[model samples]
Target: MKRGLMIASALALCTAGCGGGASGTAAAAPVPAPTPAPAPSPSPTPTPTPIASYTPAAAAIPTAGIALPLGKCVNMGNHLEAPNEGDWGRAIAEDDFTIIKAAGFTSIRLPVRFSGHAAMAAPFTIDAAFMTRVRHVVDLATAAGLNVIIDMHNYDELMAAPDANAVRFAGLWKQIAATFAAAPATVWFELINEPNTNLTNAKLPAIIAPALAEIRATNPTRPVIIGGEGWSGIGSLATLPMPADPNVVPTFHYYDPFAFTHQGATWVTPTPPLGRVFGGAADIAEIDRNLQTVRDYIARTGRVPFVGEYGANDVAGVPVSERINYYGTITAAYASVGVQSCAWAYTNTFRLRDGDHWIPGMLAAIHTTTTLR
Candidate 1:
């Protein structure tokens, strides 16, 4: 589920033409065949050139790493990332953090649209008022004893024209990193929501590398989350270049079998068909196959994998029971492979709430083995 309206349009052009020449009136003179040229001798194989191996940069804060207990998180979605709080049907009230903390959630993933509040020119400055509002939310969540992930989200302009905005993107992070430099380690920074458009897998590392360096300069020990292209899809994880900093956590968003998870979502183009059900034997197998790849990556590199976002859209037509089953299967699959996950949202779009109360089934599915400390 994306933060704002998505417009997808494709244009294609096709043309065909054929020409025929009239038959020649008289017989044409025959041209003599030229003598064949001798074949060239076979070329010898060139010696193979050895390529230099890539080594990740050593961690500035060697002792900083992801601790397993940071489990069962939820996105405070449809809130700060909007053009304004409450404009998107949800607002970050101080008590919302309390409700989340009381519901057994150990972490909160706060998505902020810094780009909307930033200047379009060089040294792109984030609005002071907006930064203050973000700081207030961070204060509220952190005070509630929840680990917080302040993510850069819904920066469509930047994603569309990354090169033009690379300096501004890094500029925003430098200010943010400095602002939160003194905050506790529980507060984590996510470089960007999902690198796409001009920022393909090959191009993403170049953009992120500078922003990361800026963050390290200010807060060297803080844990930072980074995801791959294709909207950070789990399958794209393998293509993500590992950051030199060891404290970085490679994140992926899972909405496997998109037809099932995003069914009836109005925001999606040609909206996926409705009535798709989940949790069959085949569904479980597919889930396992997807998660196994992440597990394998974790085994190869000691870094733990984080499912930064995962949830099914809550369409009115989809059966509540089916939604619960989908959530349960995904949560269980993550647990089976020791991957940390955060549900897509707390109270918007794919919400777990009705008014101020949580839907018991939805909460139960996400809090599967997690106990509130």
Candidate 2:
């Protein structure tokens, strides 16, 4: 009876914060084990699309340049909340963009997840209304001249039923592509966000290739950024064959040696230990090795490398300066190879460098470029 009471207490507390998720059969996958990437690969096979006749309008130059400027971004976590998707307005105001713009960020990454609507197919339907709420943010970013990258964030079904996953992923993309059919060049369609250890990076191209074909079928030549698996690891991206679309960019994320970045992050079960130290000198060495894997691939493949997300956690003990310094190291590696990048976020989560007050300094650090500086 006493144990039952404690279980009830725990359940009530979890529901209070991030609205309880329905039970998931997906167990956490393997930790990032080091796997040597295979030989320098050829481009992926081309798949046909229905819209073969459609030529993209005068292509808008992608924000990616040989050396991308330090653009800022935030991950938008909530979309369809409360009563309706329309009611799903930003808890923070539009005025926040003023601060963002002033801080010198030129982009935003919107992370949205929706399900249970019919259009996304049998297992998922990220209701059309829900997508509209997300569109509003994209519109706002474009109005502000900030590039927007819209992504399917936190979808769980694929991870649970690996066999049936292809239909679920492909259907979601078809629906999303049809819904956001007219996004401007400045807006990007990211196929998936951090498919990670859950989906072997090997499975990504098969799932994503069909969707890429689907998107181009409607709107030929919109830029698509593909995040790699194994939690979008820099080292792991080397293993996955990047889908080749003349306009597509191979995307990877960084939160490496997570002991430092996610220290004391209570979100995971079996709480990660405190004093989870890393980010001393050796990290740079590891980063260099990782960057080389990417650099070599890009040189071999001629595809642009986009570091879609990179950031440091903001523990009270870890001064924001350290985070900025970390950026200097990672971005420089990207810059050295002429790779473009977008920082992890614009919002202030305990883990991300906060944009609330210190954004100006952070911006100064991130935006430093040989030409711009």
Candidate 3:
């Protein structure tokens, strides 16, 4: 979930009261004009029809534990998720996958703004060309021996108006599931990236349930990742609704101690100033406490968590060393408790690359592997 912010305004309501004359009118009063009847209260919008229950073709169901192998992943961000690829100054290159695999990453999270490329009306057909383009990229990554997380990202309209867009959301997934139904299990589906705005914690179940139902129709038992609202921070886990389906994996994003991780992030309002430093003992302790929350949640609920995104921006004034320490500490912290994580990006603000090569120590820091404590 790229952090550019957009807040939606609340809809305004207006009401009018009907006026009537008293039965005992003054003698001088002429026939009072007939009072207009108050307009019938507008009918409440009916809830959308839920999808019919469907059993997976037995052959299509996968065995358990398929969603947990997401070790040492990195996000391929600011590319397809942008309103248009290359609009954010980085475009996916075939070799980029090769580089990531070589750098010791096990998977890649590819965020896509499908809403921008799909028809706005019923069926919400994704543009054929765009769909093919996404497949081409995913195929390239999987071919490079990297598991790919195909995420539905940047669906701002759906976030702002979940009820109005719920059908289109399901339609998009129906098409996506059918397209990848036969692909290797290495390809995964992430329901929506960092859901926010009107899609509150309470409202998320209604929005995601239909999409999951549609996905199971074709990709039964394949892992589907779901994250909580409020930008999917760790705390959101407390309120996130876990669907009854066994294959759904709970996910969350972390960029905690925001004063340190997002020190100079321009997209954040009242942007945190530059010059923040991390890796003090307290910082590391804070990281542990945060991750402990995830561990506790897993223990309490029996659902494993995936760190869908985490990183510190390499902004000016924030030392490169501090950024590296943040990555290493965060990565190792999650690993310490048996959770898998994907760094925020490969390039752009929080880049892990310098042109064709890994940025000096960045890879070594984030790629540190630790046995679960």
Residue-level error in angstroms, candidate 1, position 69:
3.9
Worst 10 residues of 1 by lDDT: 11-20
Which residue pairs clash within candidate 1? 57-244
Error of 2 at 106 (Å): 1.7
TM-score of 2: 0.71
* Model 1 misplaced regions, further than 4 Å: 1-68, 367-373
lDDT of 3: 0.69
- Model 1 alpha-carbon miss at residue 274, Å: 1.8
lDDT of candidate 2 over 1-373, digit per residue (tens): 1111121211221110021000111112111112312222222322321211111121112333222232445444333221223232334456655655665677666665543344444645766566776677677777777777777665555544445677777777777777768877777887776554346677776677777887888768777777665545565555656665666666666655454454333433432344433445556566666656765766666555666666655544455655666665556655555555666554434223343465435655553223321
Residue 185, model 1: lDDT of: 86
lDDT string, candidate 1, 74-152, tens digits:
9887787766777666577779888898888889898888888988787888899999999989999999999999999
Please give the distance, in angstroms, between residue 235's alpha carbon in candidate 1 and its true position after superposition. Answer: 1.3
Candidate 2 segments whose C-alpha is farther than 4 A from its true place: 1-74, 77-92, 116-125, 269-279, 350-356, 368-373
lDDT of each: 0.66, 0.51, 0.69
lDDT of 2: 0.51
TM-score of model 3 (CA atoms): 0.81
